[model samples]
Target chain A: MWQYEKKLQYPVKIANPNPKLAQLIITQYGGPDGELGASLRYLSQRYSMPYAEVKGLLTDIGTEELAHLEMICAMVHQLTRNLSEEEIKGTPFANYFVDHTTGVYPVAASSVPWRAEYIASKGDIITDLHEDLAAEQKARTTYDNLIRMVDDPDVLDPLRFLRQRELNHYQRFGEALRLTSDRLNEKNFYSFNPSFDKHCNK
Target chain B: MAMKERIYAYDFAIVEMNLYLDTHPEDKDALCLFHQYQEKREQLIEAYEAQFGPYISNVNDVQGDKFTWICDPWPWEYSKEV
Candidate 1:
């Protein structure tokens, strides 16, 4: 039961319309390490998580990722607004404009549409948490790459904010991993899947 | 717009504290901070909605005719001043 909040997680007011930049930023919308994948990964993995802390973390973080996804779309929409035919004629966005026409679509900079294969929901708690840790790092790297290429302060502000969030999420996920492992067998955390092997301790 | 920014800031703090508390559920200080921000956030939201229509769909502060929920300039819509 999600409620709609008619506001973005962060404000994205791009004074300049840069379709080229939009093409790049849209990658975060549907890229391999995009927010879409991040949200789905955590939300889907929560069902199999064995600990209360892990479950709550996944739900909260997953919801925040959805907010991030909306922010990304707002960026893309603002960047591509009011483009002329001439403006779209020579840029890489021409390919996208032909299909979407100033509309935002979830596709990578390379024009790959979003797919579920970008995420993993392993039923094992340790494996799933590790997967989440790696996912956060990858998303942080993507934001870093975006920041390096962007010069607009308007765009850079939100990118920096989102990049910081990735770091925070990584830290939280690391804590979640530590908390999870602390409850498992001290010698071998992977000896049994706590999510499924209920009687292993006996 | 200033009110909206205040609401955003307070809400942001609440969200950050929420994620922190998720991992550190027993931390009384963090929980206290979370509640404080939440209280301020409610005040900000009430003030913002009074002047700027509904911040969310459930606010239900419509007046006169027309459903204001479908108002122009959705969050995604481009505006020079946003």
Candidate 2:
């Protein structure tokens, strides 16, 4: 069971409200390589994971991704707060404002709504772990792109922290892959699907 | 506010260490560090809750006649003074 903590995993206090920047950052909230997909992918994949360590890592990382999702929402909320009518007239955020009206909605920078197809949860352990590793790298790249375009220290601080987290998750997933392989047949790790082939040697 | 930030730092360290220990379960040094952070985190949370109401909803930190759980300035909301 999950309990609510009335605090963010990290602090997001942005003094300046930049609707333009918020438009870009909202992508992380619902983009293809977003936190929502990352969390759902890992959490869903855990049921099929054969190793206890991988299962625990998936649960922990998935929970952390939820926190990251909250952080992304907070950033978007702060960046769009108290926008004047004139501020919304010609900005890129005007289109979004027409729909959400200062509310944070999950959508890519291109305005595409979030979709489950953005993530994969194949029942295969090796495939899933590789997918997770790639997912982390993709998320890290998105953060890097955001960091490149953002100059505000308030925003940059959290983005950098989040980026670092992606790297950490990637490293852990790699270790998980190694651990999984270590427990498998050294001759041909792919000879059988550990998650499905129940009769295979444990 | 500084106290809250410190608590966040400690909590983050604990979380990072926890993920590490999940895969490297046999690392005694990492487990020790995780426990140390956990202890410090508990102390900081106690102090923080005493001054700033409960950080989680289940805590019994109410004083007079108010339910502080529904207090303003949720995690997402920004305050200039903060």
Candidate 3:
């Protein structure tokens, strides 16, 4: 069960509010590579995970993605909070507002909504764990690019926190991949189901 | 409780239960904990719907009302303004 701490994991303070930059950065909030999809991808993939550790890793990292989702939403919200309809509509945010009404929606910068196509859940422990590792790297790269584009230290603070988390999750996912590899029969990959009891997999 | 924060916690708990159960499904004590967590989740969802808005997104269509709850504030509103 979750417990709320009544405070941010880290505080977000924008010395300035730039709705235009907010519009672009929000892609990380809901974009294909964004935190929301990452959380959903891992959480939903846990069902068929062959090993307990992989399933556990998905859950922990998925939960952290949810936290990252909160942080990204906080960034976008704080960036756009004080803008007027005229000001918001006047800038790049105008298109976003037309679609989401300043809501923390999940969409790419091109205005494409997030889709299940963003990530895959292969279900095989090795395959899924590998995908998770790659997902973390992809997300880390996205954050890196966003950091380059964003000049605000206020924005960068949380971005740095998020980047650090991505590194940690990557490390865990890498560990999960290794564990899954060890579980696989060194002889062959075809008979992954020979040992475990089928009736009790659930 | 603030609606969004409570709902967030509720979802977090569900995911937490799902994860714990993934590893400890046979533990009766853990199962009990899962049930307790779920019951609390149901209560919170109801409270959130009654006080704030529907719990699901997009609950307008007749078939849509099938989902019952929709559209709480997004998570960012609960954060302190930067």
Best by DockQ: 2
Lowest summed-lDDT stretch of 10 residues in model 2 chain A?
A193-202
| Model 3 lDDT tens row, B5-81 | 56556556665556555545577987887788788878877876677565443334133435333233443454343
- Which has the better TM-score: candidate 2, or candidate 3? 2
Where in model 2 is the C-alpha error above 4 Å? A199-202, B49-60, B80-82
lDDT of 1 by residue, A1-202 (tens): 6888777888888889999999999988999999999999999999998889999999999999999999999999989888789998988999998888887778988999999999999798888988999999999999999999999999999999999999999999999999987776666677878788764333
* lDDT by residue (tens digit), candidate 1, B1-82: 5777888888888889999999999999998899999999888878877787667535363668867777767888777644
DockQ values per model: 0.65, 0.69, 0.11
Better of 1 and 3 by TM-score: 1
lDDT digits (tens) for residues A1-202 of candidate 2: 7877878898899999999999999989999999889889999999999889999999999999999999999999999988899998999999999999998788999999999999998898888998999999999999999999999999999999999999999999999999988887776577777788754534
In candidate 3, what are the lDDT values of residues A1-202, reduced to their tens digit? 5543333445566657778877777777678788988988899888887677776778777877877787788778878877777777567788888877767888777788888899897656666766788888888998898888888888888899888777877776776666555655556444454224233232
- Candidates in order have lDDT scores of 0.88, 0.90, 0.70
Which residue pairs in model 1 clash with each other? none
lDDT of 3 at B37: 74
Candidate 1 A-chain TM-score: 0.96
